[model samples]
Structure formats: structure tokens, C-alpha cells
Target: MSADQSVAIVDDDDFFRKALERVFHSAGFRTESFAAAEAFLASYIPKDEACIILDLRMPRLGGLELLDRLKERGIDVPVIIYTGNADVPVTVQAMQAGAYAVVEKPLSSELLITRVRAAITDARARRTRRNQSASARAKLKLLTEREIEVARHLTEGLSSPEMADLLGISPRTVDAHRANLLRKLEIRSIAALARLFVLTELGDS
Candidate 1:
């Protein structure tokens, strides 16, 4: 996990929330606590959040409702919800709403820490993928129309001569376009270029 990444604890219980903050701090994790879900959402920063430790039973905006709000805003931060009684129906509902994990209340400190570490690791992986996809899409926007066509052909495993034949251009011209696109995208190999296409979702069609 990044040094600056932090866990956001949303619980209405003052004592429980404070205890969780101390536990996370002792385990070398930074924590931000909110007395209510509304407050957490009001000041939430998507990029800084490694995970959310949420209390399911809260006043006003409950944990499941907050999950819906996060989804509406397209925030994919991992959320671990804890409730006094995690009944089957409620647990199913939370899972359907994209809660990363659901745990019962009075959770053991060791178990909480272990799950938190896993959630943070997952969040970091997700953030890295999002960054890579954004970078690939931005670099692709710098390519010329012809270069983009060549890039698509390269991803499709077409040889320079084959692409040239399909594109109604000479093999030498196709090679030039291919080289230019590779340079513009800052990718050195066809395999890497293909992976970039996958990242940008340009290969789906």
C-alpha cells in the first residue's frame, strides 16, 4: 500500500470508531474517522481512500445506501461493512451493492487487521489498473488517423505488408505509420501495444 493511502472509518458509535482508529494506527495504517456516513461522503476524496470500514447500522444514510451513492459517483474503493447482526438477507444485500466484505460486529482485532490489509492491497491494484488505462487512452488520443489504424492492425496481429494491403497503402508506408504510432504511444513492442489496446478497451470491438 502507498504510504499516503488511508482507511476511512464510518460509524456512528464514537467509542467503536475511536478504537478502530487506534488499532489501525498501531498497525502502521493511517485512518480517517467520520461519525456518520453523511459526513464521510461529504468530504470523501476518491484517490486518497484505500478502503472504507463502514458500520452497517447508522443514522440517516446507512451503509448499503452509502454504497449506492459511491456507485453512482463511480468510486470503486473497497468497502468492508460491519453490523451487529449480519443476517443472511442483509449480507446478501450488501454484497449485491458491492460491499467488498461483510463482517459481524465485535470483530476480533486480528481478523479486522487482516481483512483491512487485504482490502488495501486490492484497492492499490485497482488504482494501478485505472492509472494504466487512463495513460493508455491519453497516449492513444495523440495518434493520427492513419497511425491509429496501423495500431489496430498491429494489435490484430497483422503483418506490415498485410496491413498495407488491407489499408490500400504500400508496405513501407504502413511500416512508417506503425513506427510512428509505437513512438507516440511510447510502447516498444507489438505485444505491449496490444496490451495497451486492451487497457483502453479499444480491442473489444
Candidate 2:
């Protein structure tokens, strides 16, 4: 590909897979064709610039099943479901499970290539967000239980004395936990720490 991005086609239909690969290659995309979703998952390394073209019907593991498997592994690669058996229910399920786009195949090379490029863009964006969230979580994990409680109270606009009262600790101890949590998270601003929690967690957390 011109931009060093690749598109993967996972379909058991040999002619269709090869034809799709040719179309993508002709349009300046690197293409990998697999005979089944099982094969693709076995070989695929997560790539931010890569997108998958999947078929709903295959011998071993179908597209929907493969999507579940991807999610289980925390793989955020974008997908475009291209299948001859596209129906309303299948389309709904694929989109619900985060497929970038779905296309019914009486194979349109032009449309498929367009969708592939869009999916690649989407996959890259998802990877960027996932990496950011992961970084926040890793930093948050550096705190102990007491430090985490102090951080949570800080997010709720609690002062050191108030946090001490809530945690049944001395005010000096509250201040110490706050300092340690901030240092471990490598963030100096209370608002920034609160923003990290908002982005990565919900409810009582």
C-alpha cells in the first residue's frame, strides 16, 4: 500500500477472495487473503492500519463468531462485513458488534475498496484511543487501595481534612496519599486525574 497499510480478506470462496485481493492491490493496498476466519485469527497480528473484509458464511468459524473472538482478545481492528448472504438480521448483528461497514456482495470493486480505506482509517483511530486508555489504566494501577480512595475523594472536590474524615484517617495521612497517588500517576493536576477516571471508568469507580 502507498501508506504502508494493508487490507485482509477472510472468505472461503477462493475466486472471490483472490478477486478482492486483486482489486485492493490494484488500488495501492497491501492485501492478505485467508480461506477462513480461523486461519486469519491464527496468523493476524493486531495492526492499527489494517482492516478486515469478512464473510458471514464460512466453513469453520463464521464472521460473527470471529468478531466475538476478536473482542475477547481485546483486538480493536476495524471490520467490513462483505457477504453474499447479507440480510437485515445479519447486518444489524455485525453493526451492533462494531463492524465499520457492511456490504452485500455482488462484488463491487469500487465500493469495496472505498469501504476498505474507510475501515483502515477507523481502525487507526480506535487503536489511538485504546492506547491512550491503556496508558491511563496502567498509571492508575500504580496506586494502592488507600491511595485510590484518596484519589476518588479528590475527584469529588474533597479537601484533605474532608478526605481524612471520610476515610477515618489523619489529615496528614490523607495529604500523603494524595501526594503519592499524584506522583505515581505522573500527573500534577487534580482535574487531569479526574478526567482520566471519567474516560476509563464509570459508576462508583
Which candidate leads the pack in lDDT?
1
| RMSD of every prediction | 3.2, 3.7
lDDT of 2 by residue, 44-75 (tens): 88776888888888987999899899999988
Q: Give one digit per residue, the lDDT tens place, for model 1 in 1-205.
A: 4356678899999999999998888877778999998899889887544889899989889999999999999887899998898999999999999998999988898898889888878766677777888888888899998898988888899998899899999999998998788777777998998888788863222
- The stretch of ten residues in a row with the least summed lDDT in candidate 1 is 196-205
Off by over 4 Å in 1: 1-5, 42-49, 72-76, 202-205
Task: Indicate the TM-score of model 1.
Answer: 0.81
Question: TM-score, each model?
Answer: 0.81, 0.76
Give the C-alpha miss distance for residue 16 in model 2, angstroms: 3.5
Kindly report which residue stretches of model 2 are placed more than 4 angstroms away from their true locations once superposed. Answer: 12-15, 35-46, 58-76, 96-98, 202-205
